[model samples]
Target: MCPLFSNLFEIMIPKLDPTVIYEIVVIVFLACWFIATVLCQFRETKISWFIRYKIDLFNLIPLWTFFAPHPGKRDYHLLFRDKITETDYSEWQEMEITEERTFWSWLWNPEKRDKKILSDVVQSLVSSIPSFREKTGNLNLLMFSTPYIIVLHAVSQCKKRSQNCYRQFMLAESSGYQKETKPALILLSVFHQI
Candidate 1:
């Protein structure tokens, strides 16, 4: 142990052991983190505004604005199928993104960003229907869009057998928050070589 660390702890609390002092420091840190996170919810107040804007160094509070202004009540389903040969097309299978949660998932989730990115790209692709209609003469222009490229890349990365050489993907909307809502077709892509 460094002499400066020991000296500082001794100066802070005279008789306590260094191990007890470390535990105390950790407890205080967690308490402050929890308190600040809760207080950040009331950010319209003066103190909360200060804590959220001025002193939050590590971005400890998450802005939970997933549903604001226009909340998405429908879910977009991406379905793809692989072509084995000229006329032997496979069944359309949905690209299922499961939100698997383990005991420690809140602390370390690798798939969290993937889910968000895919959803955003899908939303953009659905919104690109107008562009697809405008460029009806050339399908290449529709395929070259950013959202289309991203979705194609994601679909091409799916698990496939050795015989699968080409892939096609489509976006469909379904009722996510409300089961009474009707399903609709969004966009269908041409088969592209993998």
Candidate 2:
């Protein structure tokens, strides 16, 4: 025998029991379920499509992308500039979105509502861009979309509301956690009067 198996005979190996077989069966079942779930994650994949549409009658297999599908790997930056006039424009200013976390936030968090609302609004708007383009076949007409209108109106309502001033907001993406990455423009809105 090889040196690795020299002690194999010396160690008493227990015979397979009913409990051991049951444990193995459970483990194998779990493993298969995990594999099927992963394979059925993305609808674009041929396997995923077939699995979802063909054999799944009662829809047992969970088509989940684990916990977070598109996790927040980057920071969202909503920057706005005031167009004081047709000829004059103010410097871009960052909209304060993030709030400092407190230990008591877990028990009593009221201020988080505004942050959550802003985040959800932005998320919906960002997600609708591609769908809007495909539906209308014109990017310029995207201004009519509900999400765009909401953000535009919300921004227009913020800070120093007056007839003389106009506001333009842009959504930029960056990795605040990553020092090397730079901010990239995601969406820019037309100037709207306050």
Best by lDDT: 1
Work out candidate 2's RMSD over C-alphas. Answer: 12.2
TM-score for every candidate vs. truth?
A: 0.54, 0.59
lDDT of each: 0.79, 0.76
Candidate 1: 10-residue stretch with minimal lDDT = 61-70
For candidate 2, the lDDT comes to 0.76
Off by over 4 Å in 2: 1-67
lDDT of 1 by residue, 100-143 (tens): 55788779888767667877887777677676777685456768
lDDT of 2 by residue, 1-194 (tens): 88667667546654458987888899998997787778887655887787777867888888566437677666676778898767988888877776666899999988788667766677877787888789888567778877678768767766754557788989888777678988899898888766
